[model samples]
Target chain A: MLLALDVMGGDNAPAETCRGALMACDRFPDLEVALVGTGSRVAPLIAEASSSVAKRLHVVNAEEVITMDELPSVAIRNKRKSSLRIAMEMVRSGEAQGCISAGNTGAIVAGGVLVVGRIPGIDRPGLGVPLPAIDRLRMLIDVGATVRSKPLNLVQFALMGGLYMRHVLNVADPKVALLANGEEEIKGDDVIAQARDVLRKGPFTFIGYVEGKDIPVGPADVVVCDGFTGNILLKVMEGLGEAVYALLREEMGQRILPKVGMVFMLPMLKELWTRFDYEQYGGTPLLGVRGAVIKAHGRSKAPAIASALGVARDFVLKRGVELISREITQGGM
Target chain B: MLLALDVMGGDNAPAETCRGALMACDRFPDLEVALVGTGSRVAPLIAEASSSVAKRLHVVNAEEVITMDELPSVAIRNKRKSSLRIAMEMVRSGEAQGCISAGNTGAIVAGGVLVVGRIPGIDRPGLGVPLPAIDRLRMLIDVGATVRSKPLNLVQFALMGGLYMRHVLNVADPKVALLANGEEEIKGDDVIAQARDVLRKGPFTFIGYVEGKDIPVGPADVVVCDGFTGNILLKVMEGLGEAVYALLREEMGQRILPKVGMVFMLPMLKELWTRFDYEQYGGTPLLGVRGAVIKAHGRSKAPAIASALGVARDFVLKRGVELISREITQGGM
Candidate 1:
């Protein structure tokens, strides 16, 4: 029931992380949070929160803060007292069932692998990120877990992703597909070609190839690819989303009629923005690990951190990580 | 200069192709086109045009048409008299300086290799596509030209992409960067890691690594990567653009004030759409080829085809293709 949180991670650390923990505590009655950060930094935020929210939260002091650009290997070796390390340690020692960090991605990936460790039979871990599409959130797996991937790894990714979607998200019979350049079977490189054959034999609903456009269109609930491709897709979608918003703002000039028109469209625009909101999706889970380790966005606010905690709770409750391990071991290709 | 046109290719076929050719001629006085397709199918479209516009257009007798889903190797071997083949043949025989097609991409790549051939020392060709960022166009080289690429191929891509940007797009000393998962020097796969080393020694201005987010932000004028990565980026961007538009439309409903606001924003929205318009980008040029061969979008209308013709003309006039051959051979990385 207890979750360790890296409060000193992300752009607006301690403050947002503490507030988000408070929000998650308020949202979930059974949840307890171990807020790992500097005591002095988190005390004021903890004081400001309501008594009911504060009762469910506890502070685990760790003074050192790892900057956004710090090397993951260096942090893993040198910064033993860092919030990310401390939070991860909590999960390792069984003090917390899961942990979340809104910090450096590289550090989180490294910390998850080195500290939390992979499940017994899993070859490699994959980050299953929920990318918000027009109608629903499409899970793009292996979004920079490990750059190098074998065909067998992609098949494992499909299994892990399907388990998460089916158990956590409650999507029954998740339709999985390989993320290829073209929809046709013969339209990919050697890795994809080999993965296609392996995926067909897996337990998930293996649909044919889905192109890049299909990611935003929601052709399949779970789209599996190598870490490199998945990372690029995830980041490009992020950048394009920003570019689109920038374009709309630039084009929405301060004309009299248009200015008045904006008032009417503000609610609708808000609604549209919320549809693709990352805050609701929370952090990404590095599935195939022994315990839940969520990588919240680098610039995560109170809402995003709260959503991530909710996801972490769901991950543990639904036994998603355990399910992946069992599935991969039993569904031997 | 004379150019070969594939009137039977694309969704709209001879009508859009003929109109696009006429528009290109009207825009550029010195241009002449040998429209290659069935004479029976193209006659009415040509006759329907004004006398002045039709004067520069000549229909070459190519009755065969290649379907979109046909296998590339099959299209190459079996459909010899297809419009795609006839246009490539025009480039090979010196009948025309260049050719343009809105047909099967795989087929175009195959014919370009089989008929037009590689430019002597060039090992493989790359498709240099102009993707419009908010600020300007960034040339994403090797957009599905060759899926599997070596370190040397990436070096060639940088040189070829740099030449196209400098000469054709008029961006002198374009900053070149390898597309990686992260911006850090060591943060990439083995192929990218080795390519990074090769790029530093190459002729162009080699700026280290650029992430997918950097593509829309316009950090580097030319972003080089293998075709698989490049194709995913290109297609994903296209799909995301569509998704955003769909989101806006769906959200715009529900309120009466938002409905009236749409009228005021329509012009600005139209202007914004034109900025990222694929038609404006024309088509991607198969850059390491012997002659200019631009691959227009398959669903291209008159405007896109017209833009592609303009691109083909620029490719020839600027000697982009020949320059790539010379640069790659002489650079000898």
Candidate 2:
């Protein structure tokens, strides 16, 4: 099956995109990637790939490029020939099963909604990222797919997230919960209060409100919230993770004992980091979109892009988007 | 100066409160702490202290106790002589300069607002917790004081937080930024977009919007957001910290070499943790209240309680309330 990759997206674009496409080919033999970008920059890199990898890779040259700082909607409206647009168009035209972009998330979400369209009964599509908990991976849904959302949107988040976790992550009877400041039924604002009522009776477990502490450790398999809360929580966790490792490194530099201890503990520390690393986990899927779409981080390297491609491939093969479509249509919002 | 302590609050109540009171007396010579709770439960703990330490201790009987799970507003209206009420009453009556509670945060906030009253010109009172960043502290305001806040309340949070950082945190000119999902100026929803405009026109240095990553490592000295966002960010960071350490310990158990490595690294790791430890920072101040009110964590031990008492004492001595009143009244909310 053919998948589209935004070759000119992310910080290290074109080169990394070419390398990642080759790596993704190594993982999934049935996968063929259509690299969407300027051919002059991408074709040379694709030429460097081994014949086996190169044969599966094809470039979809789109002259226009959307810079990272460019406004998403503006890019969508103006740069219709941009790589982001071309990649989504491939999905829209059924030329590719799904597409993965490491471009601006806002642009990708906008593109996914405006260009690729959303599922029949879905009001808003959401981005779901896997949060690595102690014993398991919990789905953190709507991580900036929609900034301002209604109660019904959150209910849809629970539906989509529950389906993804159950099918892809292979968790039986996944617990779906709304992310709130407090776990109490009466806590949170008017919107959340309204949401609690609907989510309680919705399709999925609907275990009720959960706090931030519950997100990382897992009292629930799928945690749903508005984009605002989800985005901040995601970044804060990322910042803390970076700070902890940076602090540990600084600590080892301070004294002799720690400096010596690091030599033996390096392997364990590496394992500890790998356990929490985001690159190993694939792209954040933009659920509710008409076709399968995955958004990798903006600063994602070759490995992460490749991982995202694999995620896109899995998303198509695993029928994640199709399940959401069926769930939304049959469930009847 | 006398500060009232809710001796029956938190996980390790009366005993830890008494010990913390004694510890505070040791730290600050002029400080006196009124242990407000059941005299029977608190008096013996005070008696356990050295006679010299006991000189500064006083007991005020509060027959009612508001358990952690007790509904905050219900507790406020029904349990009139509860420890939280008595202590806040002490602040209201001008008997105590301020009060510290390691009780239910919602109840403490309610008591602080309803009993102690809000300062003049204040729209809403917010909680300010020092997020221990890598090098210094970033004042994280509105840590669940008012979950559903207006844009204007966020404006007040910025003013109060900026002032607190400049005076207490000792930054000459503190940089205040609105906490958002993205660092871009137009990132957040309508409320935040409106808040950015107000903050830009306000008294302090308005450094546009900052993401969650900016909180744990500094770009802005104070980060302002609604209570919901702030609370989730705080708890998520805490959970991630705990998870990282727990994971490391588990990894160390997997091998003898790493186990030996852990022994040598213990002191350095301890020092590293101490640097980011919340117990060292003291209690979170409830800003915009008529009197100084601090809320210690519900699970606070003796050290955290002592730290909280010290914070209350500092709030009084440093005239933090007066400055906020002056700033708000003059600045015009």
lDDT at B83, model 2: 91
Query: What DockQ would candidate 2 receive versus the native complex?
Result: 0.76
iRMSD of prediction 1:
1.5
lDDT of 2: 0.86
Clash count of each predicted structure: 0, 0
Would you list the clashing residue pairs of candidate 2?
Answer: none
**Each model's fnat?**
0.68, 0.76
C-alpha local distance difference test of each model: 0.86, 0.86
**CA-only RMSD, every prediction:** 1.5, 1.4
How does chain A of candidate 1 score by TM-score against the true chain A? 0.96
The residue pairs found clashing in candidate 1 are: none
Best model number under DockQ:
2
lDDT by residue (tens digit), candidate 2, B205-310: 9899999888878689999999988888888877777776777777766788888887888888787778788888869999999777989887788889899988
